[model samples]
Target: MKNHFLWITFLLILSLNACKSIQEKANDQFLSGQYQYAINSYSQILEEDPDNPEANLAIAESYRLSNRIEKAGPYYEKLAEEDPSFETLYRLGLSLKAQEKPEEAKAAFEKAKGFTQEEEYLAETQRQIEAINLAKGIDNYFPNHVLVNYKDLNTPGADYAPVTSENFIYFTSGRQASGLYPADGTPYTKLFRTRAEGIRVDVGSIQSLPEFQNEEGLNQAAIAISPDGNTIIYARGNSTSPKDIPETALFASYFRGAGFTQPIWMPVNEDETWWNSTPAFSPDGSELYFASNRPGGYGGIDLYKATKLANGDFGNAVNLGPNVNTPGNEMFPRPAADGKFFFSSDGHPGYGKLDLFVAENDASGKQVIKNLGENFNSPNDDFGIFFTEYPKTGFISSNREGGVGDDDIYFFEDKTPKPKIVNVLLNVYTKQRVAGEPDAVLEQARVVLYDSANKQTGGDFSNTNGRVRFTLKPDADFTIIASKSGYFSKSIPYTTVGKTPRPEDLVQEVTNITLDTTIVLDQLILEKSIVLENIYYDLDKADIRPDAAKELDKLVQILKDNPSIRIELSSHTDDRSSDQYNQDLSQRRAQSAVDYIVSQGIDPSRLVAKGYGESQLIIKNAQTEEEHQVNRRTEFKVIEIRE
Candidate 1:
């Protein structure tokens, strides 16, 4: 009997030895990233011992990495059921999430909280729970307008990080083919630009910027442009050697004509070892926000802000801390018009893939990070986010299937809820409530303003029947300048102390603005008629100059935003031409003004164009020959007020 017992013990020892060997081999395979092989090895050990937690967990991890998540779920569930721990619960939660059982996943994550004493891990679980809840509520965001399927506008690649300046929209695309052959003979990612016409991407034209291309690198990804379009910043890396330098740096350049000049790398002030990328600038150009994976960071990567020093150098960088960053990888930091920092992260518990999140500094300057939710995120990598300043149409990059390639850019109409009333109406003349007028003159009458720094702050034009309004920005400051020929020029310095007044309170608020009647100052005027010293036309053509168009568009917006005011469009010419000929030429020019406004959706009845010819010449004909040039002009006056 003693000998028989010895034999059984000996057999058990042999079995134990064999199981250890299998577990060791499985672990090695997993570390080497041979997921399928590891799964097979782990299964062999589990066959010998069905309740072996280590072996079961190994199999689950391998299956998870292989994206056979369904197969992973049962194995992880068994391991958790046998011996619940933080690691086991985490794996179980992740597996259930992959299987689309969100409620089960949440329960697993909550169970994980009880298995760990680490505050960091506990906070992380709470964050994940919040992310899941926020994602569940995403369908609630209903935007003002949605442009779902427009042909030219919707490209195939993952396109995002849009920066608009003047008439151009610059963005990054992983779908565009790079001319150079990658190591595997594949096209790398690239950056492309198009016009912002708000249509079927009827992009007047499309062309890749030479400056943004990385001849033999991973590909330039995130990009940001300055307000005036003069400067740009982008992120660049070498994909072939991602770990050689795990992160990317920011580069800046000046726009020289059609191309950008040589780009200059922007490095961290004191630390050159770490990497910096995804640069976003404040509207006033005073502050810069970027992503970095430098040492001392809260986690994988964190958002950092650098203020411009008085000496024209960037200040030392400041990490956003626990509020904005997580233990998971957080990259692609972009600051929106509302001063909120938008970024992408994989560490937070999310629906899937990397999710987009926004971090903002509250009144006390404390940071608050909020997951943007499923509206902007998918079950795939969602990065390179950007939105328009005035109208919230923007784009995001993703590889979430249903796309053209591994990645495709999706232009999304921002469905974020906005304030009840967006802008306030304005009466620029005499600050009185002037309403109702013919369509033509009313359409042409508008106001626009520029700051000393040449930035457009507020103002929009009117529609038909003489009315106008304005979309007041947060704390916008500008010098309001009004223009309409036959009347005098007007200017007003305006400033808003706090956030824009809510839409509900705006109607009852009396925001008054007065405009001067255009006066043909005899001594101030040069010759036969007052000339448009600021209005410039392109060479040998009647088409207004590009700069002139920008100026006029601002005026058009002023009229469109406000309503109910009338004006007379008039044109004058130098005394050199016969009265009859000058009169005819002036009238045609006046009509041109009428046409542009009408094309912009303004009413035709509000405006009336008339040629005064040399009759209203501001300067005497006897002045120097050069003086006569000033007499040729175009003007507008508030001739009639409807209400």
Candidate 2:
């Protein structure tokens, strides 16, 4: 009986040792990033030791790190139920959020907040909570625009991140070449191309680049072609050899007529230990952008830009600064020609995971970041966006649910009813001399448009219709000056303020509206008497009346506009008054008018006060009161125009 008991105990000891060996193997697999292998091993242990905390957390982290975040949610939830620490709770929230379970995600984030007093941790938790709220109302954005899968370009494997250059579309796809990458369990991707007409991709013409860089089991993806399409920059790596530290570096390959030349290692990749990929060029090809997790970054995997030197090689990389880099990963930089900078971010408050964000400059020139919102963003991984066309037409990448497979390429267009187009056309008609007579077209007159700052924005000569047209900027102030050799220059203030059509008021694709104004320049005719209209005074008074002062203001503007002209502001009296008395009274009235004109900031030397009195009367012997009254008047004539 004693011998039998010892045999059973001996077998139990052997079984215990075997279990320890299995645990060590599973740990090794997880540490080596063989996540699927780790998951399988962990599952076997969980069948016997179902409550093993180490096994559960390892399996959950393995799933999350492997891009199986959807599968990680249940494990994270179970771990959090057992022990709701900050890390577990925060990770759980991330999984739930990526899966589009906003309510549950928010609840998890709220729970995470209670688990820590560290500002960074608490802030991250709060960010997740705010992102949940952001997702809740996402449907209100880009109302009519819904993202459509590029059904022809997509495959059962992943196909994403397409960019257009001329009539060709370049992209990354996992279906055609290379072996599986254990990281996401997807086939290694290669750079591919096809013919494109604007946003439409010609799927049948899709062709992968020759294997001049990555080997059979390696990967090459995320490309940037120059505006001339002569150069292509891409990421190539994934050395599976256990002896080498895993590294992905950038390579530059040139178009050698029919195909790409073999890639050469880029010098801008300063560190081999850091992960660097996702190359993009500025619309003008002056700078190159990529994502890197090198030291001195704001956080994990921050975006960086390197300037293209005159030698055509990239210079030192620069961080996009605090406004763009968050404490979370930001990648896939795409700067458009429309002055908008786009990239994917998990740092900025977003719907979930990596959301598309556009960085814009406001009126103050401050950088403002905004989510692409709703249709362009989802709760899953969305990154690597490229413009197939400008003004909101593009191909986007997302791993959102209901895709044909993992990470599909989606075609998007801004279909918000073409928006409201208000074309504010300013038609400036230059007419003939003073009093705007003849109404004949005046050609060859120089017309200049200046902003409120007196800076000339545009200048053009009057056409056959004496018309100079310009498209006015909205909510602006401008001054239009028209001048000719024999004519006095005239400055007119034109304000576009309160003149624009509201966005909601325009239902048509384009609303054409014209603002017509006539600029009549006076010919510099010396001694040509031009009567001033509506110049009147209280009966028998020498003091300038308010009405008379108002008329004199026009003379002030003319003097100001034609800086070289000296005008004679003269007044005459009726024949009834004694010649000397009328002369004295008229002289005082004319002087008073000159004084008012001087007060309006016109140069004093530009005026001459003259009084003709009864000597200048039209009716030699006025009998009727109307004829006598007509003899009292005020007039101005250009006496001298100084050079």
Candidate 3:
């Protein structure tokens, strides 16, 4: 028994030493920036000790640094559940968000905010929540569109960044080639030119640009050509040295007689430490836009522009500022022919990864950034959009699923028809009543349409036919008012919220429809009183009842519509109560009605409340119950009207 106990002790010590050695190896790999190798080491450790917190965190970080955030999700989730540290929770939220699990990610971020007091972390957590909310509503802004990948141009490897000029399309690809990049064991990216008809590219006509080919182990991608097709700017990376960080720069090439000249590095790439790539030329060729990771940038990568100088060299690079950049990468800056700018960003509130965005100056000359939304973007990298001169059709690169390569070029066409204008015809009529006489039409009435903001949108005088027409936009609310001499103005509210042409009905370029509405104004006689219908109250109650409030709401609207009118609101009671009691109760009720009107934003100075008890009953010597009910009433009379 004693010998067995000693042997057990020795085995336990040896096991602990082995575990320590394995942990040290994993740590060494992680510190040296070999994230893939570190992941392998930490994963092995986890196989034996699944609850190892350090190993789990390390593996998650490794996967994130290697751009495999989806693979890191489970590990981060495990760490967050076990440790619940602010860093672990934040990282888990990011992983979940990138995987399009917004609700779960939001919970993680919310929990993280409670654990940290740092302002930066708190602000970032709030931004993430806002971004998730914004992403949820992105579908509303996108038009109906479809994307089709160019299968002929894609390969089993990576193929993306397509630019078209004339009938030929230039793009970058990393397919089966003679040269390979040692960094990731993939073929070095090279430029290829092919004949394209619309969105179909002929693979058999593919040819390499011999004049623009790079050395064996370097990468060349993201090419831009001028409008004249003579000058070309392409990104080149120095990937030959395995020990040093790769440096990318932009190079310019000029077309010569029957060939192109040797590429020359641009002066804008003077900083050796910064990366400059993804060049785009303005339509007039006066400015070149590119993405760089240089110092003094607002984010990881920002869009910059360099103007063409008189001496044929480019001027200083200018940052596009916060409107065009964010705390994340902003790349692939492309300007359309109509002065609109397009780019891709991960910092903005997007579905995930890099989503496409468009920026343009509004009517007030302020830059507005709008997301391209789900139709033009996906929960993956989408960038490098180029449009034709008309911009009706364009090509965009995306790394979404269902593609043949790592990154594939897609074609999109705008199929949404223009909005049609709606015509609203207003017919105004006036009716004069005098002791059962026939009502006569009063022409030449003024009709005006007021928008929801109370601004007069359109107005006109009624013609001989008592009709006035105006054009209106769909999905809006308006109030139509009609008035004539010696007539009480009538106001009616209308809305076109659901009056647009339905999707199934819009089968043509334009659909015209007219909506006809009639407004009838009542003739107003001097000293005439109008009894408000359905104004009633419970016994001994001074407060306005629900039914009574509804009846008074029309008066409130009238007071609001006619701002210069002053009126007296009077209350009356039946003969059952004593004269003093009835007078006092009616006065209180009248004051209650006036107070309610004042509460609805009407000016108190324009209203006067009065009581005329059983002394001024409408039915003289009432006998039936209905007559008594009619005697107890409320009425309004216009005392003064200001033009």
Identify the leading candidate in terms of TM-score. Answer: 2
Judging by TM-score, tell me the better candidate of 1 and 3: 3
Name the better of 2 and 3 by TM-score.
2
TM-score of candidate 2 on Cα atoms, chains taken together = 0.68
lDDT of each: 0.62, 0.80, 0.80
Estimate candidate 1's alpha-carbon lDDT, on a 0 to 1 scale: 0.62
Native-to-model Cα distance after best TM-score fit, residue 196 in candidate 2, in Å: 3.4
lDDT of 1 by residue, 393-500 (tens): 766666565665555566767555554543333344322212263213334445675765868765655445444445444355656665443333445566543445
| Model 2 per-residue lDDT tens digits across residues 374-465 | 77887788888876656667788998888887779998887766556677899999987536346567888999999999999889999999
Error of 1 at 188 (Å): 3.5
Each prediction's Cα RMSD?
A: 23.0, 8.5, 13.7
lDDT of 3 by residue, 458-492 (tens): 99888767778877766789988887777777789
